[model samples]
Target chain A: MQRIRLLKDRIARKLMLSLTIFSGLIVFIMAFGLYQRSRPILAIKPLNELLFSTSWQPSSGKFGFFPFIMGTLWVTGVAIFIAVPLCLFTTIYLSEYSGARLCKWTNPLIDLLAGIPSVVYGMCGVLVIVPLIKDHIAPFFGTFSSGYSVLAGGVILAVMIFPIIIHVSSEVFRSVPAELREASLALGATKWQTVKHVVIRKAMPGVIAAIVLGLSRAFGETMAVLMVAGNVAKVPSSVLDPAYPLPALIANNYGEMLSVPLYDSALLLASLVLLMVVLSFNIISRIILIRVERNIR
Target chain B: MDRRYAEEKIFRSLTFASTVVIFLTLAFILATVIAKGISYMNLAMITQTPKGGYYLGKEGGVLNAILGSLYLAGGATFLAILVSLPVVLYINIYSKKESKIAAFTRFSFDVLWGVPSIVYGAFGFTIMLFFGLRTSLLGGIITVSLLILPIMSRAIDEVVRMVPTELLDASYALGATKLETALKIVTRQALPGIMTAVLVAFGRGIGDAASVIFTAGFTDSIPYSLFRPAATLPLAIFFQLGTPLPEVQGRAYASALILTSIILIISVVSRALTGRFTRHVVK
Candidate 1:
């Protein structure tokens, strides 16, 4: 009986360890799958040509990814610019100034914001942000936008990432020891100065990691960005210009256009690009976060 | 001193104002969805599927999507738990505390957790093409399971890691096998956390639209089998809002409301149940 029980335990351990190994392998498998699907287009066109070409005429078998790549960059860039400052301010306030009661209310509210579906954000963007941009902001800049500009997408994405950036940044801020803040104050630094010269300096790496994670989230955001970003296949010259992001390109054209030869490959290549970029950003951010945690300890 | 105090006040207000802006934004989104959603909501909206000329202001409902989202998220969460529990249990219970494999597994999950749902959709679409599978509920479930597996594992792993080494040693002192200790003691110790993780993953799976858009292949009717195309709430809203008709657009708000309500309920219930289950937890 003892031997049988021991044998059973060994078998169970082997089974579980194998399952764990298999789970880790899945990320590589997904990357491989995307790459394999994208192989045809890679074979047909040089990678540089495929990535940098301006034209996106898929009908004649010309599939240039430059416009979509730029579109993703522009929208994500604008989102980072808007979100980072606001999030930093909010995090500073929450961690340094706010009372525990305020945080008690604010944290759950932030979680709720994060939990709101991206589709709802898209719908809200259509109703509110798009019209605000089309009628107000664009005209203020002396330009006419149909409300579906890269600016609109950026605004919506910025809002979608607000919860993420704020949540991560608040945790980062909290990790700065109380002793450090007290020490700064003992040296006669004002509250703002303490935050600026002490807490912010200590938490800079963590803040950057938070922002990078937010960047990855913004880059891979599909439905909300797709709904607002005017799916024009051009490199946007300004925030007000309509642009088609890579995820939008894939989401918009994938299932419906299998008949278009090389179209599937083109879209799959877009997916591969998204996968690589987002994964790298995530890995970088994770490394930074690990380092920050080690330093905090 | 005067200059320093003035600068501090200005910066303080700026931060406070930004914080207020976030709160106002949250309030605005909630109010808009609720007000617009309530205006169009009726019993039929949740009881019947779309009918002929539905996008043209004709009578119909999003019952198909409501049910389909439930089925798809439900199945995916189940599969994710099945896979996640084993992987996490193996890491926490079966492996050395500082094992490289355990560390690597956790790292991979972190990366996977960050992967976008659209990539998953595209990857799922590619896999379907290879297997000659059309968009179906099965595909959606599989893809969503992949998307949520990491989320479930990481959440569960955090809690399981907190299970004290002393407890495991005690179990082993009683001659309990590793498998028995894992399944009986560590799992029980982490039950409340596990409950929250499952609900969180389910809420995520249900609200996600991008991963399912290509794999599920929306239909007007409720899906009857795994092989059949299924309508989901987010896609239902997407399609309805795409139409030019005002009535259809109104219905889309109604659908969004339903989706939001389901997620809200899941969160609330998770919190409540976690509290209740803590009675059984060791700590």
Candidate 2:
């Protein structure tokens, strides 16, 4: 009986180990599959041309992803610019100045914002932000904007990513040693000075991780951006100009790829690019977060 | 002295303003969705599937989507839990605290968690092609299970890691096997956390749209089998919002409201249940 029980234990341990390894294997398989499917496109089109060409007419065999890449960068850049200050300030307030009552209310509210689906954000953008931009912000700039521009995508993304930045940064700030704040204050520094000079500086690495995570989310965001980012396949001349980002390109065209030869491969290539970019960002942020935790010890 | 005080006042006000803005944004989103959706929300919307000409701005409800979302997310979350429990157990119970295999697996899960849902969709599409499988509920569930496996496992791992080492030591000292201690002691201690992880994964899987768009081709009727195509609330909202007709667009808002409510309920219920479970926890 004792020997039988020992054998059962060994089998269970091995089974669990294999299951854990299987989880990692799935990611490898995904990357391999994407690479295999995209090889045909990679063979026909030089890497530089496929990545740098401005024209994207798939029917004409012109599959430059440059415009979509630029669109993604511009939109994500704008979102980061808009979201960072707001998130930073909110985190500071919550961590340094807010009373327990306020923190109690705001934390759940932020979680609620995080839980809301991206599709709902897209719907809200379509109904509210899009028209608000078209009628107000666009007209002020003297540009004939349809509201479905890069700016609209950025604005919605900013909202979508705000919770992540705030949640992570607040945790970072909260972890700063109380002694650091007291020491700053003991040196005749004001509360704001303590937060700005000591707490924020100590929390910088975690804050950067938060921002990187937010940026990754913005770059890969699909349904919300697709709804607002007027899907024209051109590099936008300005924020008000319509543009197509890579995820939108894949989602919009993947279903109909059979009509045009090599289109499927091109779309697969786009997915590969997105996967690589997102995976790198995730790794960089994870390294930073790990360092932050190590330093806390 | 006055100069320093004035600077502090200005900066404090700015932070306060930003905090208020975050709250206001949340309020505005909820208000808009509720105002637009309340009119069209009815029992029929939750009870009946889409009828003929439904996409054409005609009659019928989003019952198919409601049921399909529940089915797909429920199925995926169940599979994820089955896979995740063993992985978490292996990491915390079988391996050393800083084992390389455990560290590498955790890192891979972090990367997988960050990969966008659309990439998963594309990857699922590729797998389907390789196997000559068409879009179906089964494909969606499998792909979604992959998407949430990392999330669920990571959450459970964190909780399991927090279990007091003394407790495990005691179990081992009593001549219990590693598997028995893991199953009997650690799991009971981490039950609440495990429940929360499952709910979070369920919420994520149900709300996700990009991951399912290709693998779970849309339908207007309830999918009777895993092999059949299924409609989901997120996709329902997406398709409805794409229509040029005003009524169909209204349906989009209604669908969004339903999805939002379900997520909100899940988060709240999980929080409450987690709190209750904490009371019974060893820690």
Which has the greatest lDDT? Answer: 1
Q: What C-alpha lDDT, on a 0 to 100 scale, does residue A167 get in candidate 1?
A: 85
- lDDT string for model 2 (A192-241, tens) is 88887898889989999999999999999998999999999888999998
Which residues of candidate 2, in runs, are more than 4 Å off? B277-280
Residues A103-202, model 1: lDDT tens digits: 9889878988888899999999998988999999999999899999898899889999999899888988888899999999999999999998999999
Error of 1 at B199 (Å): 0.6
- Give the native contact fraction of candidate 2: 0.76
Per-residue lDDT of model 2, residues B90-195, tens digit only: 9888999999889988989988988999999999999988988899998999889988888888989889999999999999999999999989899889999899
lDDT of 1: 0.91
**lDDT value, residue A228 of candidate 1:** 94
Pairs of residues at least 3 apart in sequence or in different chains that clash in candidate 1: none
Q: What is candidate 1's lDDT per residue for B48-137, written digit by digit as tens?
A: 999898889999899999999999999999999999999999988888888999989998999998899999999899889889999999
Docking class of 1: high
For every candidate, what is the interface RMSD in angstroms? 1.1, 1.0
